[model samples]
Target: MEVNIRHARAGVTIAVDGLAELRELEWHDGHVRIGAGLNLTEIERRLDGRIPLMAEWFPQFASRLIRNSATLGGNIGTASPIGDSPPTLLALDASLILASREGEREVALADFFRGYRQTELRDGELIRAVKIPLPLAPITGFYKYAKRRFDDISSVAVGIALELESDNVRRIRIGLGGVAATPIRALKAEEALAGKPWTKRNVREAARVMGQEGTPLSDHRASADYRAAMLEQALLKFFFEKSEVVRG
Candidate 1:
């Protein structure tokens, strides 16, 4: 059943279907409060055309309708290895707000998921909202690849954030989705880019390392080789795209 709470000062809180609970909501800066019940469609539209921080990294998410009802908590709470949000959120260093019925609180983001479809959230504790620090945006983009570009789930997704410092990568962050049991951070790829001169060779080497980081499996949608190649191409394209933006 849907739970609704009427606040004296704040607006009503409606329990979102298919989620844990309607804990709370708040928005500040570029960050928004998301009750577990707040559906994806709502968040996507609200976030639409705004979260360009990882645009060059991975742009293709669910459609408007899908986004409308899909809860933000569902994406993180589902913890699906192939789910779209984790990798980008991981790359962006988002923080999860956990709440207990007793009013206790906890924060987790990095190193939260233990395995596929698993998370660190304690039982009966609900996700209040996630906090994302807005991007500084020197060279940032999201690149996602799949069999069908529009509606199909990704075979591999890359989220790369870079800061160009004097023709070299001063800083970089990479997040990979659908390449492993959980959306993953490509620390190796980031390391390869940092302090290294931006060039085709460096990008290729980083792509190689990223491929190694993936444990892509043969599935109905894709073969292991295709996933690896997709990651390689995605990373390469992201490098060039960001290079252009940062150079400009």
Candidate 2:
């Protein structure tokens, strides 16, 4: 029922006192399933960091020891503003299976998160599995912006997955975090990029609109002005990564 800071503090108090409590992880196509008891370290060794993206992103995370015990499912359930994977999974159009003693329900990533520290998940239910769509793009850009690169939660984090077709964005999904109450889609930005020439102009304008889409707070890590500026820049970077073509 606990891990990380609380577990580290409790030490002896937090133990599998009985033999009756133990479970294994579950996984399916392009996704993973697990009991609520799974932790981050077990996931790492289990996954062996084979998924290049997840592995690369791990180092930017706060703690290895915590990662050892911090379960992704738990984190998802917690739904913190700065939680890392929500934006990533949301951009990927991931689906989740929520289960209870009664039955199971599936919800889209976009709908799962309701607000800061809130999700659509009901009480007495646990996340059963995460279903991620296969990537349509060979190139993806995941950005986390904070004062320090390592172990710092971002003031703004952006995740975009794009599939380029004949120099245009044929398929696209955009996700943003730390700039809003919850990690959300930059749908306007996605529409702007789709089927159009993937040029810097379009990218800039789309990014501008994306920044305008949300009202971000001036937090300790960044200001509204700064976050807006970076969103624009994020658009441009994503564009270049997705396609070499330009709007000119």
Candidate 3:
């Protein structure tokens, strides 16, 4: 649509919707392989709540109409900085299977993007599938802050997955969008929280680190400071929500 609107020229466009290989969903080796051609709507229906973070995210995506036609491959391939899929998938510790005429290679989703709107997808290659390893993080959350509640681009988006040992953080992954040149993992925040008690003081410090994870830029949707503040707030919100769940 962007190409048509801009009257841009293209060499070729290949449609893979009918390709059986690109449309297969398989569960094997303790991981689910999501076919690249599967539409977002189908993915949501098929996965159900198996991937909790995605279940929380799907509705907040563009909308039913847009999701009907949007595929995961297309979403990730575009490498849009504000794209919602990247953060959720990143927190899941997913990988992409890239296929070319020569062969196939798997690349960690974290390492797939090189810059704004740039991906590691080589010429003559396409994302065959996304592989997410099993035994998912027990606690997960997805948050998108936008001007409107629905059908709006995010000002800041966050996806988080965590495993806890008693009250201590066993492992945690935080993925963020709309704050940098590419979707990124909150590694510093994760480091600060890992192996520590999930207490208010520790989380507060980690949240502060999260606020500084990406180089946020001011745009029409929000100010740079607001975006950073939201990053901090999102983590804090997740902790509170989980705490309430435990209390109840």
- Winner by lDDT: 3
lDDT-wise, the better of 2 and 3 is 3
Question: Which runs of model 1 end up more than 4 angstroms from their true locations?
Answer: 1-36, 54-59, 104-108
**Candidate order (TM-score):** 3, 1, 2
Per residue, candidate 1 scores C-alpha lDDT tens digits across 41-64 of 555445664666534322366666
lDDT, model 1, position 237: 81
Each model's lDDT = 0.71, 0.70, 0.92
Error of 1 at 177 (Å): 1.1
**Deviation in angstroms for 83 in model 3?**
0.3
Candidate 2 C-alpha lDDT tens digits along 1-248? 24655664543554331112223555556565534455666655676854444554566666787676666676677887677777776776777878788998989978888988789988777776666655334556677788887777788877777767777778888888877888788888888778986677877778878877566889778998898777777777766764542332
Could you tell which candidate, 2 or 3, scores higher by TM-score? 3
**lDDT score of model 2?**
0.70
